[model samples]
Target: MSPETTDLPLTLSADHYHRPAPEIPGAIALIEDAQVGVNLAMLQTGALQIAIDSQAVKPGDKLLVFIDEQLVLVSLVERPCNGEPIVRNIPAKCVPDGIISLSYRVNVEQSAPLKVLVKTELPGGVDPKPEAPGHFLLTPPQLTPTTLDGGQAETVRIAPYPGMRHNDVVMLKCGNWTLPHNVTAHEVGQPLTFTLSPEMVASNGDGAIVLYYTISDAVGNRATDHSLGLAVMIQTGSATPVAPTVSGVDQQNALYLSQLGSQTVTVSLDTRAFTAGDRFTLVWSGVDRTGGIKLFTQEQILERQTTLEFSVANNTIQELAGGSARLFFTRTDAKGGEQQLPSREILIVGNTRRVSATEASPQQAPGEFAAGGS
Candidate 1:
């Protein structure tokens, strides 16, 4: 029952533990109230310390901690202290990028997979969830073209905290971008400002941007408090758009299969922020009642392409007839983020067109009616 054993507040998740290493993957079975959680403040300098309930597994079992699905850390269980509890430290690079999912294993198979929604890497001596991270009060929370002075730089005020001192680093994160600054001797215990350049603000794109700053004191302590965040919006024409524009057919347009032999539905998005290699998917829905084929879909761009000409085949159109179909396109960024526009619906007229029939009875030699009455 050492003080460090408190780092793991929860039990190892799976009651089952496999032999070790590769054998543990297929041996995990989530059972009962068993669980594992993160103690941010307890995170050591270079490794993750986990506590396992002595009653959960026997001594000498191996423990594995996976970060972001990669087996980055491993440790062997130490003997329990009179059934008090056991703490095992897995020495691996601890990174909380995006969303962090950490799981534990004993021996080969038993597992208690734990997913903690922590997005910051906190070093020693700081509360993982600090009451006040940095004095990050944005000068003007909202930004438009006029107020922003055509993408003029915006300033965020970061006041010194109780432990603020020189050599401490302050890092500001806006949307996906970050800006860093050093705390000067004169700035200690005084208000500091981080400037967001026009390009920096624009890089965050449109819509609400989460603004928060982390502090790494001279003593090497870091923490980010995400409970409340500064919400900033920049509505420039070139910023990342809120959603893509699905063009070609609108609700007012009723397509006739006879006329539109091959249909092309164009999707327009802000190419100003388009990143190559990102995937754009055209989701065509609302045609479940159509005949022949119930679903319709197409793919890709504009010059960003204005005349993208992503054509739909006649057979697809035939299947999509007899009902109104809606289309929306989504952009999947390289980081696996997605943004899509509202769906556009088009009414389809008539059933799927079929090949015309030709009657081929021998024609009476240039003349008479074939009917008996004649």
Candidate 2:
């Protein structure tokens, strides 16, 4: 053998090229080893250079390499590619977003088919398992903000990946509603899209819609469960407006007596219009579990958009039992139009050493700072 032929590391066992003596005389059969492997497995660029293990190869023994599922014959040379493994890139047709395709160029000197594998690594998400070459379907990636506004036509796109072939069936389901009951993966480079009909809009008060899907190949191999589902939120219209009020308490309706403590509260002004110089009063009334009530009231004139914190003196925390409170707001507009909206309820619990007397005290004067106004 020339030095060029010696460059490839022999991958076949010494016994692979040897055959046992035939029990029957005139039948001199050349039994090739069933075991198969490749040397110089790494691709230089896009091309693969490999050697065959069979000794029966002739000077013109034809060799074939499998790229993807397609086969291309390679010219066998006494000195292949000038003794250097040539590189080859995967075809542009095989490259798709979020997909990693593995193409193997095997030595088909023997008659059996060789296997290739494809894998995927989705950033910040599950890595789909590699699958053998042939028919396969990939699971769609997770969709963000699974919710949608109702009473309108909407569209959502799922990330694309390998193993998704044209005409593959993609089934989508959302609570009692299944549109395009059977859709196909038809476009390349573009994400799979689903259209939500106006009829799909959620009605009947804040109803939730969840989207689930499954992908199947023509031969019916489905992507594993791990990669097959997603969820969506669907509504017919804007959520009902919540009245301008206090919401989200950092501390549950409770006061701690350790020190002059404060809890952050969210003043939700959902859709409540305000004009300049509006005067607002927040009245907090807590009723002890036994029906005894303690009241705290504060008033503030509007300045620009403001930041607010709710605080209570340690002495104040000492005066309440576990119960609930009602928040009443009185707003006076620039024209002296006073509006007393419906009161909202808040919970209150006392974490003091003991429950203080429930006797009502005069509403204290408002504080200098925006918070802690009595």
Candidate 3:
């Protein structure tokens, strides 16, 4: 009833139609809603628009906004700047000739400073390589002999044992890190010799035999295994033996025995003066008292004095006619010296019996004289 009550149908798709305002036009813009459309006239006029629905713009996104009529652009609004929303502006006609490089500053905490490296690939497959730094290696020197006597003098030539040459130099290597050392010719031998300070010798002990030596090689290298070592030994004196003496009645009896029944014998010497290593000898000849020189006896005595004592006994004796016996004695020293005592001369007497004749004639004479007178 109002204007004949006739409603016209609206065509949704067409070449030209009414459209909403663009949320973002050429240049760049931040929008709260993205469901809006741009005017169809703006599209025909080469105007660009893009929709965005963001609480905050992200790193990569498109943004659009209108700067003026007949000018449109496409832009990309990356990250926020200065804590504010970012908008990148672009023209719609053609891309700008200048560079559109991006710059970003980020904060990263580090305990150490950052290191920078520039790598470049050379042509013809050539590449840069890291080089090693120069270094020094040290070695210990070697000595001809490792042992030396403390009693020797310094500055003597050094020579090793049997296999070593007479004039060969005993060298010590100056290692990469050490100094050179040398010894004189007299310093090396079966028992290498060297002069040691009195303080060093006394520290060990008086009259102690000490040995010392060091080893090295040519380079400046040093070795703990090749280091010097020392040894020491103390000296002592020799022992002596004690002398001995003879005593008591046995010694006297021995002397008396030597003097008995000996011919051309000498007096006995005292046994007390004898030393352990002394020696003695004796010789004797004796004749029995029976006037029988055919049965004469000869004797020899040999004596050695030692730490221990021993005795020899002879029981041989010859009996004479009258119950008398003859004996001989000889004495000897440890060194084979001999002496003999005089032979003993003993006397023996026989028992005697006496007989007397009776005088029968005397009685006869007295009787005869009386008869004759009658």
What lDDT, from 0 to 1, does candidate 3 have?
A: 0.25
Output the number of the lDDT-best candidate.
1
Tell me how far the alpha carbon of residue 123 in candidate 2 is from the true structure, in angstroms, after superposition: 19
Per-model TM-score, in order, reads: 0.31, 0.27, 0.15
In angstroms, the error of model 2 at 190 is: 2.8
Which residues of candidate 1, in runs, are more than 4 Å off?
1-150, 224-227, 238-374
Which of the two candidates, 2 or 3, achieves a greater TM-score against the reference? Answer: 2
RMSD of 3: 60.7
TM-score of 3: 0.15
Cα RMSD (angstroms) for every candidate in the order listed: 26.1, 27.1, 60.7
Each candidate's clash count: 15, 13, 62
Q: Report, for every candidate in turn, its global Cα lDDT versus the true structure.
A: 0.45, 0.38, 0.25
**Backbone clashes in model 1:** 15
**lDDT of candidate 1 over 237-299, digit per residue (tens):** 645435334344433344555555565544454555566666667665534221122555665
What lDDT does candidate 3 reach at residue 147? Answer: 30
Off by over 4 Å in 2: 1-147, 180-186, 203-205, 226-231, 237-374
lDDT of 2 by residue, 2-102 (tens): 11122322233335423211111111122122112111112212222333333344443333333333333233433334433323222222322221212
Task: State in Å the error of residue 73, model 1.
Answer: 32
